[model samples]
Target: MTGSLQGETVLVVGRGSGIARAIVGAAAAEGAQVVAAGRNREALESAYKGTSVSVKGVDLTDEASIAALADDVGSVHHVVSTASARARGALGELSPEAILLSFHTKVVGPIMLAKHFAPEMPRTGSLVFFSGVAALEPDPGFLGVAATNGSVNVVIRSLAVELAPLRVNAISPGTVDTGAWDGLGEKKGAFLEKLSAANPARRLGTPEDIAQAVVFAMTNTFMTGVSLAVDGGQPLV
Candidate 1:
C-alpha cells in the first residue's frame, strides 16, 4: 500500500489525446510498464512516439474487442479509461444515436472493461474511470454528457461494492486546454478565459493536473467508491 508500482503494469485506454498521453508519461515515470490502448493503432503508436510504452488496439464499444485486449494483456496492476464520445445538445434536440454513443463510450464501455479486466487485476490494483463537471453543473446543452458522466459516478460506487478489494473510482475534470477546443480557432482563447474567470482556481486545468489525480487514485489503497472532482471549483461556481 505504501510502495511504488516499480514492476507493475498499467493499461491506459484512449491514448490518442493529450490527457491520455500525460497519464502514460506519468505512469512510466513512476516505473510502471505502460500499455496504451485505443481504437486507432496508428494514433496509439503515434502518441507514444519515442517512448517504451506498448500500444494496443481496442474498441471500447465492442465487448469482443475489449475481451481480446484483456486476454492479450494478460494481467495489469491498474486500468484507466479516458475514452469518451462527444455528444452535446438540448434535451429534445439531440439525436438518439448520439445519446446512445455517449452511453456506450462513458458507461457501457467501462462496464465491459470491468467485466473482462477486473478478473485480471489483483486486490491491490484499481480501475479509474473518467467523468466530467457537466454532471455536477448540468449545463443546458450538455444533457447527454451530464447523464453519461453522472451515471459513471454511480457506476463507480456500485462496482466498488461489487468488486470488493479491487478499487473503483472516478475523476471528474473541468474544462482543460487539451486541444479539444482547438477547432474553435480564435474563440478558443476567449472561451478558456471565460471559463478561468468563472472557476475559483482562476485557471483552466492542464492534462498534467488530471493525470496526477489519476495516478493518485490508481495508487491510493484507501480510496474507492468515490468521484474526485478535479474541476478547479467549476461546479461550485
Candidate 2:
C-alpha cells in the first residue's frame, strides 16, 4: 500500500446502493477511515460489514441532516457521493413531486454536500460525484435521469473551478450490473442481458469497476476538474 490516505478519512454519501457500498469497501481497503451516510441502516451495515467503517443515517436532502452529518463525520479528506434517486419521465409528463424527487437527491444533494463539506475538506482533498452514460448521450425514455445527470456533469467542472485547490471530479459509469437493474422490475434480467451484449467488454460493469475509479479520483492528488468515463468502451455507441 502506498499509504496515500493511511490516516485520512473519507466520507461516502449514499452508502445503500451496491456501487456506493463498493466504493466504501475499496476506500477502507486502501487504509483510509470510511464513514458512510445514508437513510438505510441495514444497507450501510452490509456495505461496511467487516470493515472499520462508521455508519450514519443521513437524509441528504434535508439541510439539518446534511449539517449534522458533516459535523458528526468532521474533518473529512475525501467525499464520494453515489446518492441517486430513481425517478424517470419527460419534463411535463412526470408530476411535480416525481420530478422534484430525483432532482433534489441526485442533482441538489451533491451541491448541498459540497457546500457543507467543502469548507471542512482539506485544500488537497478530493470529491467524486457519480454520473451515468445517460449524461453523455441522452435518451428519450430516461429524460429525468438524463437531464439531472447531464446537469451535474457540468456542475462538476464548474465547481472544480470554483472550489479550486481542492479537487472535484465526476465519474460516469457504464451499465453496471448493480441493483440498479432491480429498479427496472419485470425487465431486469432481459435489460441486463441486452446491455451486456452491447458492451465492448461483452459484460456489464460491476460495482468494483466503478469503485476503483472512484478511489482513483479521490486519492489522485494532481487531478481535478475533469470527468473520468469508466464505461468500459460502452459509450462508443
Candidate 3:
C-alpha cells in the first residue's frame, strides 16, 4: 500500500472510462509508469498526454493491431482493461452479430491481451479486467452486455488459476456515471435510483470509488482469481 508499486509499469486498456482515468491517475501518483491503450487515440492522448503515459490507439479485435500494441507495450508489470463494447439490444431482437460483438470486446479482447502480453508481464505484475453490475444485476434489454461481462469475469477468474505464476482479477462496478451509457440517458437516472434504493449506501458507485479498488488489487499480492464487486452493497438487494 505504501511505495509498494514504485517503478512498476502498468498497461491500462480502455483509458476512456472515468474509472479508468482515475485509476491511471492514481497509478501515476503512486509512481507506476502507465501506458493507456484504446481505440480512441485522440481521446486517450487528449486525456493523458504530456505525462509519462504513452497513449496508443488500438482495436483490440484486430489480432495484428493488438499484437502491435503488445509489442509497443513491451514488458510491463500489470494490464488493466476497462475496454467494453456496446452491442446491447433486446433478447430476440439481438442478432448473433450483436451478441458476438459484445463478447469479442468484453471477453475475447482481454483474452488477446493475455495471449500476447502474459508472457511479458513481470512475475509480480497482475492482470485486471472490468465487469459491469449488468453482469450480475441484469436488465432485459442489456442481455448482450450482461452475458459478455459474466463470461469475461469467469474467464479472468479461471485465468488467474491457469496463469498461476501471474495474477489476474476483475472489478464489477455498479452504475458508475461514465459516458458509456450516454445513449441511454433518459433511462439511466430512473433505473439507477431504483437500483440504488436497495443498497445500504443508497447511492450508485462512482468511478473514483472503483479506481481505488483497482489500485488496491494491483498493490496487493494475496488477491486474485476473483471479480470484486464495487456495487455499494447492491448485491444485498
Candidate 4:
C-alpha cells in the first residue's frame, strides 16, 4: 500500500460485518476519512468501535434513504457498496419477494447510488461494487444470488462508460469466511475446508483479500469497467 488514499474521504456502504468491515479498517489505515453506512446502526457501531470511522444509516431498497445519505456525505473521493440482501434457496423453493428484494439490494441500490452520488464525485474518483463467484460458477440453490451478482457486472461496465473518467468496477469474490456463513453453525468449518480443498488456491478467501482488491480498484487509474475476480481460482475449477 502506497498510502495513496491519505487524506481522502471514502464512503463504504454495508459496514455491518465481513468484507465491508475489513474495508473500513483498511481505508482508515491508509489514512482515509472513512464513512461507514448500513441499515443496522448497532452493527455499524460495533464494527467501527475504537476507530475514527463515521457511521450512518442507509437502506438500499429505499431511494429516498440513499439520497439522504448522499446529501449528508457531501463530496467523497471514492465509494464502495458491499450491501447485499441474503435470499437463497432452490428455484422452486424461493419466494418472488425475496428474489425481488435481492435484486433491489444488489442491483437497484448501486444504481441509485450512482444516480445521486456521481455528481459529487470528481474525475479522479471511483466506484467499486461487490459481486460474487456464484455468478460465474453457479450452484443448485444460489439462483437469485447468481442472477443479482451477474447483473452487477453488467451494471458496472455500463456505468464505467456512462460515468467515464470517474472509474467504475466490480469485485467478485469466492466463498469467503465471513459472518454470512454463520448459519451453518458447527458445520461451517468443515464446509469451508471442503471448499478450500476444491479450490486451486487450497484455501478459503479472507476479508483482507477482498479489501485489498477493492483498494487496488480504487487507486488504479487505468482500470475501469472490469470485474476482477478474487476467488482463488474458484471460477476456474
Candidate scoring better on lDDT of 1 and 2: 1
Q: Kindly report which residue stretches of model 4 are placed more than 4 angstroms away from their true locations once superposed.
A: none
Residue-level lDDT tens digits of model 4 in 111-218:
999999999989999999998998999898899999999999999999999999999999999999887888878998888889999999999999999999999998
Higher-ranked by lDDT: 3 or 4: 4
Q: Report the CA-based lDDT of candidate 3 relative to the real structure.
A: 0.84
| Least well predicted 10-residue stretch by lDDT in candidate 3 | 176-185
Ranking by TM-score: 4, 1, 3, 2
Tell me, by lDDT, which candidate is best: 4
Point out where model 3 deviates above 4 Å: none
Assess every candidate by TM-score: 0.96, 0.92, 0.93, 0.96
Q: Encode model 2's per-residue lDDT on 1-237: one tens digit a residue.
A: 566568889998885667887887788788899888898878788766776888888886787888888888788999888888766756667677776878888778888889999998899898888778887777776777877788778889888999998999999998887676676788889988887888788898889999889888988888887889888777676
RMSD per prediction, one decimal? 1.8, 1.8, 1.7, 1.2
Q: Tell me the tens digit of each residue's lDDT in model 1 across 41-147.
A: 99888767888999999999999999999999998989999999968867889998999999998899999999999997898999999999998997887898999
The regions of model 2 sitting more than 4 angstroms off are: 46-50, 90-93
Q: Assess the local accuracy of residue 214 in candidate 1 as a C-alpha lDDT between 0 and 100.
A: 91
Q: Against the unseen true structure, what C-alpha lDDT does each candidate score?
A: 0.91, 0.83, 0.84, 0.92
Candidate 3 lDDT, tens digit per residue, 1-237?
A: 366569999988885558889988888888888889988889988887577888887787787888999888799999998887777888788889888777787788899889899998887889999887788877788888888888978898789987887899999887776776677779977776787787778887787898888998898898888888888877567
Q: Is candidate 2 or candidate 3 better by lDDT?
A: 3
Give the TM-score comparing model 2 with the true structure, all chains together: 0.92
User: 145, model 1: CA deviation in Å?
Assistant: 0.6
